[model samples]
Target: MPYLMRAEPYDASIGAVRPLFFSDLGFTSEPADSPSNTYFVRRIETPLAVRRSLFSGSAIGGYSETSFGSATLANDDGKLDWLSDLDWDGRLVEILYSPQERPALADFTVLFSGAAEQLVPGDEIEIQLRDLLVLLDVPASRGQFGGTGGVDGTAELRGRDKPWLIGRRRQIEPVLINAANNVYMVDPAGFSSLLAARDMGVTYPAAVGDFASYTALVAASLTGTNVATSKTAGLIRLGQKPNGRFTIDAEGVKVSGAWVYRFADLVRHVVTSMTTVTGASLLDVSFAAFNGLQPAVLGYWCDGSSVPKVRDVIDQLADSVGAYWGFGEDRLLSLGRYDGPAATADFEFTERTIIDLTPRPVDRRMKALKLGYRPFGVIFTADELDRVNVSAADLEAFQNEYRWTAVATNAAAAGASLLATEEEGKTLFDTEVAATAERDRRLSLFSAKRKAFDVVVPLTPGLTVGHTVKLTDSRFGLSGGWRGLVLEIERDANDETLKMTVQG
Candidate 1:
């Protein structure tokens, strides 16, 4: 299967020119939005060796493990050496292909897209490409520490030096003020002392044991930094305006109250907040796709002290609600659920269409799936008392494997029906209801005998991860009506083979 591949440079431009003598005639500059203001694309076409792999999670609690592929260009003529120019550093490169059998250049299709990594010129110009997900991998710092004697106040006591008199204190200023909910987001910045656990204010230390006086000191430290909203179920209520003396103690405020948001809104908030803070071009958010997601709520704490990777945060949030994150073929990051695929399969592959097929091993010997979770509205930690474990077992089997997540309260309900033996753990989720639901959902998925297949078919365009498709194999008893989720795709333009890793 012969094909032609080309790489188009991003942000390439040439200076616009006009006859110098025409200056007397006077000409207006092209508006920024004008079509005439477009940049020139000097297409780079050369002998190339490339391999591309794309992936997405097949179920809840899974994530893409794709390392955006690589390409090598033959620079025998030195014609392509210009790619070493500093101007091309970190540029977006669009890879395109045209079937040798096709006659028209217009028929060319976008095979892959990515940001080019550093380029080192040599006999062969090698280029590394990274997918859009790379943007989400940036480390996000939520709060800045002022150290011992800076903006955060000193570590010493104001007057005397007794244990109760001298303790660390913090005054949290608003990081983000959401007028829609009257919520002021503040990065706790590792300040562990606060009192209110829920909307109804509860006094500190009294609820957290004998540190009442110390809790008072911590509460007093955070006098003005509080959730300004009226008391509501599951929402944080800090000191109300005029009566600004510290009200909540550290232990309670640590898990105090999370600002509840619709799953979609929460995702947007997190992504936008990170992008705005870090200045990373995270592409665009699929608002409509997220809004169409199943009904769920996310409780997010503003404790940015851990400095987690954005990808982990988003993945855990989705997993908590039986959802998964996927970057579509178009490179748009979207969310989908293991249980809630499209009502109908988008594509179907039959014996006639499948060139090669190998079924993945099925794990039926597993006896039970014990999923661990914590009650809602609590900070994630290794505390055993703060966690709950629920199991889904097949009495006939003896094996047991445990998966833990900090973000799921209803693990029992949101788990997928088909599960694999190995799964990574995450800590995120605010309520037991969500955790239990997730546990049940995973138990159902893990207890069943799930099957996956490595399939190679003729170049199939428009195939993407997370989309459900039907498969039929008379020998395997698949009637074509059964749908499987696409977990990974490897496209080899050289051989015209489109390989897929699918699970059902």
Candidate 2:
């Protein structure tokens, strides 16, 4: 791991790029995680990373720590004299030494607002500049000095891939796509038409390449030989007039108030609909294939009023396919996933890959699976919505199939557990099969967590979340075997230790 730290804040006022000259500074960012855009810095001279687009707001955020450490500064004149020209808001604090592979050393990492101290001469003038984290919360005036202004009004609150930003005391959310009224259309006409529509807006083959296109992938998983028009469910309600535009809080439109989609068409439609949410493209796609992931078809609803966040929608949809979706550098705009074979025990690990390991016990695995399908119309005036649920015909086969199987739902309350919500897979019958497939994939050695652990290893460059990794262990009968998905990675840039949450 080569040591590199650089802070370049654009000076929108001057119309040029200026690099911050840091006596010392460091930054850490995780584009893969939720709210992937953020950084922390402490510096000696001037702040970097500022932009006028964000006026009165310093690009640098702040953090403080006490009861942990101390810091003293020498004046710029290079003497024991009091510190001079103190501009704490955006200056990079320099580090004389940075040690690599040392998790305990915090020399070249971000700072915390806890457990620390800074000492300056009595005569010295000190200024406090914050890191970008604190910068998001600007203009803290208005409260009568107790100083806890509920939440900085100007601050942008984001989750998944959407910004839950406030305007006039209300949340303005990204819009959701309505299938009947979206940029893409549902064609009951089958394969060629479907492919044509997918490539319609394309100017280059690479731009709309067939490589892992969700449409192409779902086509592979198509249950029938071709599109079945009689079973296809069309839209009952498109949305408000300005289709594809964003809206505030909203719910998925009822699926034509009925289930008419051929199972194959339903899967195809939902997968295709997802790709239309703006900025759903990937930064880079691969020619390689991997395991534990198969090209999957997922079912979801798209409301016409607002455009949903691309990464967020893909994430929720990917779950249906036992796949993953998010950015690499993880900008608000981007998507990625691995759809291939069942998990094969690969990527062997030993002392070299495993830094710290802890074992945990998993209580139960579902033995039976009952997926409930709620129809589009007529909410139950009766006590149970279960009365009308469409059930999978093959629940018993699952019990005879898996090793440590538990019912997907309790038998008496069957049908509701997996299909608990009114998800718009209006494609009936086979949704049960899709849901069951998700369950089987989850029960796999790479997907199941009958054996699990938390391991802190060096950052493996290309490792993305939701991908499978093999852990060789003999204690839990995992000597000649053991593999699991990388559920979460706690990236520690300052400490240089990447902690991976494993499940299998």
Candidate 3:
């Protein structure tokens, strides 16, 4: 049978297939280290909290009352309740500090009735009731003030717009004309005696108690304890009053209070929660697309030595396309192992010709293995052989010069016509022979012949099928082709063999 010499590198005398190299294939060189493989960016975390407070009173009071009834001893108008018609409604105020000294400070005290009285020179009685009241009011006033600017509440009072109050009392009173007054008699010395006369008890406003509870409620509303409490405490101390209802302002304008849940905690919870949920070591929140389907398998018809670890080769292939995916290394080995033997044998036998010839003198009766080498001969179909476009004269010229064989139309047929034979047969044979010889001569003159034909026979890695692929090599003349998917990949550890089922 006539054989066709597949293109090879040394066949410069005849046309051969050339393989493409990396550079010639139009592939740009990738940096040894790619940013996609190394760079990792993380998101920033936010902060959050809750707060509470009590006694949100103002710096000014507008009401007071006085009464007098019993008087005893050598006392004058001793037992008395000196009262002023002043407003006591609490006003939200931001505290302010003053370095300047002014007489207005002294005059301001008159509004609160800052006065002192003494009954006797030796036996002293201090009528410093106004001073004591002022002293008690200072702490409450300080607490109401808020912010660095110390502006008393906002100019626009809270509760006025919403018609609702936050603390217990939320009403504005009218100014009274007549000064209501009262006088109570208690011998300066007997005042203490009266206190001793009956068991004394102090009463606190119910609203004050409620304010304490509300402060805590506000604090708890903040998510992160430390952050929440700190901010809430600041708002209360600063006594910031928003331009709305007292309750609304208190609830709304609080530090970081506008947040749903502490943003800081939310971030932490999301990252931590998702990590546990996914059961993945590396979890990332990104806008990149994720594939729901498993990766497809690709098969290559390569020599056993040329095929590396399947996983590595596949990964390299995937990397060329900037894809992020993973597969077990064993799977690649299995595919390579399974296809290795068949591919190796086919490549060796089809691409190379082995001649086993024995050279010996007619001496001892013995047999030995001797090796000889020759170029791969060309094979052509009978139809191609018949269509030789050459002249009879040319055929005689070439056949007389070189010992060339005329391929038979049918091997079973005998006595085919040859040169120096019958008219019709001679004519056909001469023409075909000349054409074939000339074709071979032209092939011999061609210089850039292929040394090897890197046939890429795509097979599936597993059960997957019909995968498209592009193979590029500057030194090789191959381009795009389709690769088959993988059906199964199995590895034999004991025998060190990898087997694979690839789509044909």
Candidate 4:
């Protein structure tokens, strides 16, 4: 299908923005869009995120300042100036492109992040539209006409995305939660309270859509009590949120709520929640079940002092199930797990439908495993008065399997040490068992490789990232049904086909 595209520069400080130009030359590469990886730019002292490319093919037009081909901003392009306001680092150069060809801009659907710093000169002023935004325009370099005196080029225009209300974020001072901090039930309400505590407003439906009223939610480490109660606790950071969702103006914290069921739950919630989180609007809040789907009833709580950022909460939630999230379809957020339905081989692809394919070598660093155990089974027990007290140890023989084992250890890994976190289960044996199970799970998928291919297939319902696809060829050792998680899918406007990246 032919798609209509628009690229506009919007400023959150201003009301609305109009597209200065639209290009068929755009090639957007979104490696991942979940909160953990949806971060767009890396500033001067910051590290780079991913390898980005330019918007090749055609030139953009319409602005009077530099007629689609001007190198310098001789005339004031207010939006460009606004982005420059962020110094060298910037997100104001956002483009809202939609399939909808409408008169009013409010109806636009998908968001397009504008460009990175322009290295080469030309009319090639870049704008990024990515999981956040994507762009890096460079000229043919030489053979161009000069103004008059000497050879001149557009100064390397560097800027990041102007702050948008949706993904705007701020980081709280770090809080260590080792049984020494404030505590509360980090529920939708408790989470909202953290936002309120930060002077940010918290919004959610009175009744949780797909969530339950389960008693004894997860214990916390932020306050007083030790058990799963509101009295006292603390929290720890399971994962980190990217830099995008930090800033908010006087509006404080604007949150919309939604509920999704398990079986199809955490992955969908993390992906759609971050990407499609339209300002104050969240997923449908109707009291709908997963359509009679008897999936696991889910709700999460944590000490805000530890799991502070919104993305961190989502990341930690999904991490509990051995899953991590990133963007896939057109920078749409995605959450993928190491375990899914096994497809032994059938979904094969041949040279007829596959133009070319590239398989990435497994990065052991990305999937390192270090199982841990309590040297001596011990833990903190709560007293009758709700105070935390480190109880005694049981030195019983043959009580458990192996007392301790470092099954998946890599001694070369930056000076390895202990791999386990302190267990807080009711029984010391139960805690040790839980720790061992997690260790084995991580060992199974230690060698993971994400592959990308240029295919003639369209990215239909079954062909998106996170779906299973099979490959059969003597080259890729495809005798078995090697399943790979689709990491990215991009439509080639020129080829009129789709390209998919998958990780197995």
Highest TM-score among the candidates is held by which one? 1
**Each candidate: RMSD:** 11.9, 17.5, 50.1, 18.9
Worst 10-residue lDDT window for candidate 4 reads: 61-70
Cα deviation in Å at residue 271, candidate 1? 1.9
Please give the ranking of all candidate structures by lDDT, highest first, separated by commas: 1, 2, 4, 3
What TM-scores do the predictions have? Answer: 0.62, 0.40, 0.13, 0.40
**Model 3 Cα lDDT, one tens digit per residue, 1-504:** 000000111223334422111110112222452211221111101000101000011100111111101101111333211111111112111101112233121111111111121112111111111111111122101112121221222333221111110111101111111111111111100100110000011111121111122235243332211111122222221122112211101111111232211212221222222222121322222111211111111111111112233223323222211222211211110011111112111111111121111111111111111111111111222332222443444333322322233332221111221211110011111123332432232222211111212222211122111121222333223223212222222322122222232221
lDDT for model 4 comes to 0.30
Q: What is the C-alpha lDDT of each candidate?
A: 0.45, 0.31, 0.18, 0.30
Worst 10 residues of 1 by lDDT: 160-169
TM-score of 1: 0.62
Q: Candidate 4's residue-wise lDDT over 1-504, tens digit each? A: 212233234434554553332323232323442212222221111111222211111111100010011012212333334433332122223323334333223333332232333322223333322333221111101122122211111122112111111111122221211111221122222122122111111111121111122222222122221122221111112112212111111111123443332423433433334343432222222112322222332233221222223444444334333443433324333334445334653245654556567665433332244433322111111221112221122113212222443445433342332432222111111134544565555444442233434334532322443466675545666554355554445543334345665555
Please give the lDDT score for candidate 1.
0.45
In model 3, the runs with Cα more than 4 Å from the true position are 1-481, 501-504
TM-score, cand. 2: 0.40
- After TM-score superposition, the amount by which residue 179's alpha carbon in candidate 2 deviates from its true location, in angstroms, is 23
For all candidates, what are the clash counts? 46, 53, 71, 49
Give the per-residue lDDT of model 1 (tens digit) for 1-504: 223333344433443211110111122223542223333233222312333333243333445454465555566778767666444434555555555453233454666655556566776666676656666776544334343432232343122111110011122122222222222223332223333422212222222222222223233322333332212111222433422222222221122244324455555555555653221332244455655544443444433334566676666666566656644446565665666335689888888998988888644423344444432222222321112221223111112122344332224333443332434343344344555565657655655556778888877667766667788877566864567777667776556677877777
